[model samples]
Target chain A: MRSQSEPTQSAGKRAAPPYEQIKLFLKERLENGHWTPGALMPSEADLVAKFAVSRMTVNRALRELQLEGLVDRVQGVGTFAAQLHRVSSSLTIRDIHEEVLERGHVHHATVHLAKAESASATAAQRLGVGLNASVFHTVIVHYENGVALQCEDRYVNPECAPDYLSVDFTKITPTHYLLDVAPLWEARFAVEAGLPTAREAKLLGLKITDPVLIVSRRTVNRGVPITQARLVHPAGRYQIDGVFKP
Target chain B: MRSQSEPTQSAGKRAAPPYEQIKLFLKERLENGHWTPGALMPSEADLVAKFAVSRMTVNRALRELQLEGLVDRVQGVGTFAAQLHRVSSSLTIRDIHEEVLERGHVHHATVHLAKAESASATAAQRLGVGLNASVFHTVIVHYENGVALQCEDRYVNPECAPDYLSVDFTKITPTHYLLDVAPLWEARFAVEAGLPTAREAKLLGLKITDPVLIVSRRTVNRGVPITQARLVHPAGRYQIDGVFKP
Candidate 1:
């Protein structure tokens, strides 16, 4: 039977720092089955005597435990041992280009359109520019291992980078090229579940009305508007996560 | 008028640490118009003469700049100052209860169903438990500010926590109560976009066939089969993100 107490690491009878001793002591107890999840532990005074440490040292160790979500302290009630909640720090959203390269798969891009176009009201408001302004537009399809994975529909403010069309995007991805040209100032993002139209579904090699993941990001570069891109990915193989420091 | 050759801080600084000086030197030159986006930068040899520093130091600085998305380098071709492409971080999916708390809105959950039944094949496989074993199920509608915002359909394995039904869930959130009792071990997640059924939509206060964001998570507790939860939110107000150190 596993104990609920934190495992304590005993330091050989040499003088160890009070804080470290207490941390190890609690850790071993937790691991050795003394304190179980939701089990209230001894009071601060009790622990101070048990560890031959001052209240402040015990408090410091407990404080760290609380921060790590290993224990919950309630007013008037003693601290209780918490169940181990593994908050993973490994989740990440990688750029498609990087992801493809990392998988040792061949990456190819086809830029169907790259030219200046008049902006609609939605585009203008999104770019924070005037209506009908010349906006640089690009329609790109990215493929991995000969399968199309994403369709990037993008709009850029011409005033932000006037020579947008001059660069060849064949060798580098739009994300790679833009990051090189424009330093990102700020960004806004949204994600939604949507059904792709016949055209979008065809491009993604999926059936019509299949559930799709749509990610939209609006970026501002320098003092002018940079670009807004809509990335469409199939839902079966994608998930995103980030850490929170409370 | 910003001139591509306008210099500011990079001029006449030769005594500082080479990397720091080079970074600032490039920054000022870029800011003052010496190096506009897409403009070819001077070769390492040229920078070596300009700052009287080793090529290695200049190379280190340029490498950092490249990683920061400020410059592009081509084999046998010169380096070019790149446009600022915005770097967007991945999003954190907030629990519905947490989101309501963040908005300072009152949150309430109306439990639609809570019962124990023999685990179905699908449920057993998902929970990694024996088929036909007892399992707990819960269906809940979450309201924020008196508006229905989410529907949570969850299932739990009774072997992981026998006292689950004995607790009153109306006064405490399932998440809070479960966290207090059993700590989460590992989680698998999936996200997709879909239209909800008429009943689900009504429960969430969403229009029929409206785009909805659905997230499913299966959590294990200390190697014991625990629970799986599916959460649906109105797409208009919900977003998901995952960030990584790339």
Candidate 2:
């Protein structure tokens, strides 16, 4: 591939810049699956020799790829193809199982706790129910391709979903089931960075000190609170992405 | 104050629940400036005696307040009124100074670094400039009422904002200036939770171990890359809040 001293003339057109050529070469390889995720590409010196360009040119190509989220470069370690982490915005409530499967990855859930419990004052107030009212509480750890991705702690008002406890959560996510039972009319959400509690850390398989991206959401159906959930994701593994107009 | 309770009948209505009455009482005190931020509230035992309710009711009331972000409950240290933290969402890009003033808080900026430098490989790629192209970089710490709220590190493409370095940043934030110079056409943003770098921690007056909420944004004008910025906020002090319809 390096033998072509002249940038391949597409119908005898002017050659693209050396850096652009190098970037396209690497991008094509990535797209063709020749270089799998986590596979290291050629070093700067190697790329320069192959492209017959200055080392700065090769560096610029790789840097652009890194900025585009295609590669990860460690100071001491060579550059490796990066696995793109999916970004979710709080603008839309998406079913995690569907999201995972849409990415061509396997999805599974481990139901840690699902039971009817007396609502704490906080839950009761948020749910607009009398204190100590029966509420269905469920905690599930969602895994994508066998790796834990989200820890969902949810409280469902018993009046909205009386059969919440009888559902087989492993087969269908609580989010899906709840949406079916109580169509969402409105929701208020807050996203924050927080250190996970010990139990949450253990369930997410994260370090106690590691920060987690927490999305606290309360959904209402017809002006009545149906469910409130706290979704936790490991900091390094997840991000929220959105686009906005002025 | 609690001697003639009878639920403190307002217009001789039915008495509110013990916890609801306590919640309202505390909320009134907080709103009327009787209890200031960070001021410790009466002990649970005191609340129980004052309301003529069980200890459980007082505990529940405080817990609810804590969950609502209105109070901080330290296990052994007691509950104290919490300073309301600001939350921003990616949906809209509001001027920080405007946001602070709207909240009745003073806003100020401390310009840390403002200079022209050759773009690093990363910046060059993100800004779509040639290798070693001149780029204007600025670092500013934004404060609200003398408390550091955000540390903004921004890189501007010289082609987009030629007068970037000449502007007095302390008087006008880079964000404000940039918005004026380049009317935002479109923007892409990603928010993540991570540990701050040493310089970011120092500038934000946060402990190195503390996590931060980071929002990385890249704005374009007529499909041309203009500026890329990383806005960092101390996790304990900031959150991102948003509402969306299905």
Predicted structure with the largest TM-score when compared to the true one: 1
Error of 1 at A213 (Å): 1.5
Where does candidate 1 stray beyond 4 Å? A1-91, A101-106, A158-163, A197-202, A205-210, A221-224, A235-246, B1-87, B195-210, B241-246
Off by over 4 Å in 2: A1-93, A125-128, A244-246, B1-93, B125-128, B244-246
Report the lDDT tens digits of candidate 2 across residue range A1-246: 546753455667787888888888887776554665578888888887876888868887887777566778987779886543211111343567877887899999999999998999987876667799899888999999999989998899888888889999999988777756654545677778888989899999888999888888777655677788888988888777666432
Instruction: Tell the DockQ for candidate 1.
Output: 0.18
Q: Model 2 clash pairs? A: none
Tens digits of per-residue lDDT for model 1, A51-142: 66668778878866675666788979999877653342223455777878988988887787898888989778767778898898887778
B1-246 per-residue lDDT for model 1 (tens digits)? 323422223567555566666877786676555777789998988887777767877886786777566679887898897654333444456667776897799988888888898889977776678899899888788888877777887788776667877766656767666766655645666667776767778788777757678877776645675777778877766666433221
**Structural similarity to truth (TM-score) of each candidate:** 0.62, 0.61
CAPRI quality level assigned to candidate 2 from its DockQ score: incorrect
